[model samples]
Target: MSEPFSLLMAVYRGDHPVHFQKAFTSSVAGQTRRPDQVVLVQDGPVSPGLEGAIEHALADSPAPVLHHRIERNVGLADALAQGLRLSDHDIVARMDADDISLPERFAAQLPAIEGGLDLVGTGMLEFLDDDGSIVGRRVPRTGQAEIERYARFHDPFSHPTVVYRRSAVEHAGGYRPLGLMEDYWLFARMIHAGARVGNLAEPLVMYRVGDGAYARRGGRAQWRSELALQRAFRRIGFTTRGQYLRNVAVRGGYRFVPEPVRKAAYRRFIARGERARRSTRIAR
Candidate 1:
């Protein structure tokens, strides 16, 4: 086994029990290099079935487990913050309650840390369910240059595939409760703070995006949240004035579009981002 590390996850009542069970099995119980401790935060009260599932998964876990229950729903960012604090290891891996991590996920991510990276992430494949019909594949920027350049307008890492040094993240302010863009915000701070980062351009996690995901991508509230995030990025010099305007014009407007339009644009954006990453890699 590799050096001891912790796996962190948060589950809420909204998540299905079956999906959570499979996620725990595929990401924790079946890992080639399992975590030394699995720390899960119950973001809020969950359904009885989901509660039972959590208990069952822990009972069958390969490593020791810490299950923390919150009195009320605190959302993912805050919940993950609590979980991160509960971790016992310096290195921590992240998993979602609904994603299926490959058996070799940690096996692949840990070596990147060995190479001096403080944080490492990989690409992911999006599927509708465990039936395994993949609907989308996301590719991440492999070089630091590409990652920095791309972050002005796009997410450089697939959130679920990230394995990071807890100390490095804590130095960068840990996980803040940013609305809608928590992961991106944390990554921007980490990059700006000069944290060493790397990415594997290969998919290691299977992200579950069920029906109506595109439709749920937009609303008046979502636009407001995104607007706030952009303003914060601008205030912190994470984005140039022109980049900020472009982001507002592009990502901001994306919130009000119809479902069909959002769905088409979403796929195109993914493809364009992947192509851009490839070009940047070649240039490097």
Candidate 2:
């Protein structure tokens, strides 16, 4: 028999109730090959509506839902770590409370893990709000070599779209409290530990990118965190001093720039047209 997988998700007070419901429904009820277990961590206190949605989704789900709660807000990193501990299965698939996983996502990812990949992620379509119209797509670099190269400057895998072996994560010390760069930090450690990672060429999740998303990426705190991560990469030999400096000069400057400029740059560089083309191809 194939190793069973558990879907791991963390929810907080700030999450929109409607989005949370849709995300839960899509990940659990909509999956063609549903997870054997769903491990949900309540990061902190949530609104009654959000709580109700979780209850409703869990009540309707076919698979078992293991719910864990923290008394106070411990943030994503710690919350995820807690959830990871609670997950009973050897394979764990990460899901964001505000994103929608496509019906075939689990089915597509299971084979990769079965084939000996330690970590696997898929492309994701970024949409605006709850209407689900695709605004952009993140087509991550596939293959171990390409992923390792991209990991030096950027996160090659979309966190919510990734399915990874629990043993691999445990070997890398699991998730740490790294602020906005927590996922990236963990991925770096996993790569350094010789974890085999890859990304499927097709989008498997609908990522919700709100208007203020880019604005939130800027600011001194974010910049400091990013630079610190780069420095850590250099210290660990994942990046050269020259690469670290170049990252600072480029990504660091973006943090100080106006939001409009950052948005424009994001659309031009990070977002790609390939998702639309892929959708078109799938339609025919």
Q: Which candidate is the best by lDDT?
A: 2
Q: Give Cα distance to truth, residue 104, candidate 1, Å.
A: 0.9
Tell me the tens digit of each residue's lDDT in model 1 across 211-276.
Answer: 768877798878988898899899999999999999999999999999899999889977976788
**Prediction 1 global C-alpha lDDT:** 0.89
List the candidates' TM-scores in order: 0.94, 0.94
Candidate 2 off by > 4 Å = 271-284
Q: After superposition, how far is residue 96 of candidate 2 from its true place, in Å?
A: 0.3
Lowest lDDT 10-residue stretch of candidate 1: 128-137
Error of 1 at 185 (Å): 0.8
* Whole-model lDDT, model 2: 0.90
Task: Put down candidate 2 lDDT per residue, 1-284, tens digits, no spaces.
Answer: 47899999999999999999889999988999999999999998999999999898889988999999899999999999999999999899999999999999999999999999999999888998856688887877877997898788888888999999999999988998865899999999999999998989788999999868998999998999888888778878888888999888888888989999988988876545465446656997
